[model samples]
Target: MANHKSAIKKIRSDERKRLRNRYQHKTARTHIKKLLTTKDKEEAQLLLKVVHGMIDKLTKKNIIHKNNAARKKSRLAKYVNKLVATA
Candidate 1:
């Protein structure tokens, strides 16, 4: 569909970036799920750091919005804090 040489190149690069972004987003979500499911406070605490870092990276890259990242981080921290309080 892209006729111009530059247009074709742009399409190719966009596809590559899309796949990479999807992978990173999925990885961050997996970490968040794992963190949410863990019963061990210690393990959850550690995973929270990794998840937060992943979220920050995504937000920095503009894959996710700043507010979206903040909301996710907030929910996770709240959940982890509740776990800490209960245990």
Candidate 2:
């Protein structure tokens, strides 16, 4: 219950941003999981490209930590490479 009009508007904007960020983060996680589960190297590689881009963007926006982004990318890359090598 914001008493001031500006304060109310700020709260509304914050809520909107929060929801948008949450959506993006969730999407990123879902895509990462999908990539991990994918057995097809080609498809998974494509998905990894997109996922990596999403992670980089999130890192740039400070939605996730830089180290977190790096770690995720590293692990995913390793998994994807293993799939590629085995295929």
**Highest lDDT model number:** 2
The pairs that clash in candidate 1 are: none
Q: Which has the greatest TM-score?
A: 1
The TM-scores of all predictions, comma-separated, are 0.93, 0.91
> Which regions of candidate 2 are displaced past 4 Å?
85-87
lDDT of 2 at 23: 95
Write down the lDDT of every candidate, Cα atoms only: 0.93, 0.93
Q: What is the C-alpha RMSD of each candidate to the true structure, in Å?
A: 1.6, 1.5
Report residue 76 deviation for candidate 2 (angstroms): 0.3
lDDT of 1 by residue, 30-75 (tens): 9998998998788888899999999999999999999999999999
* TM-score of structure candidate 2: 0.91
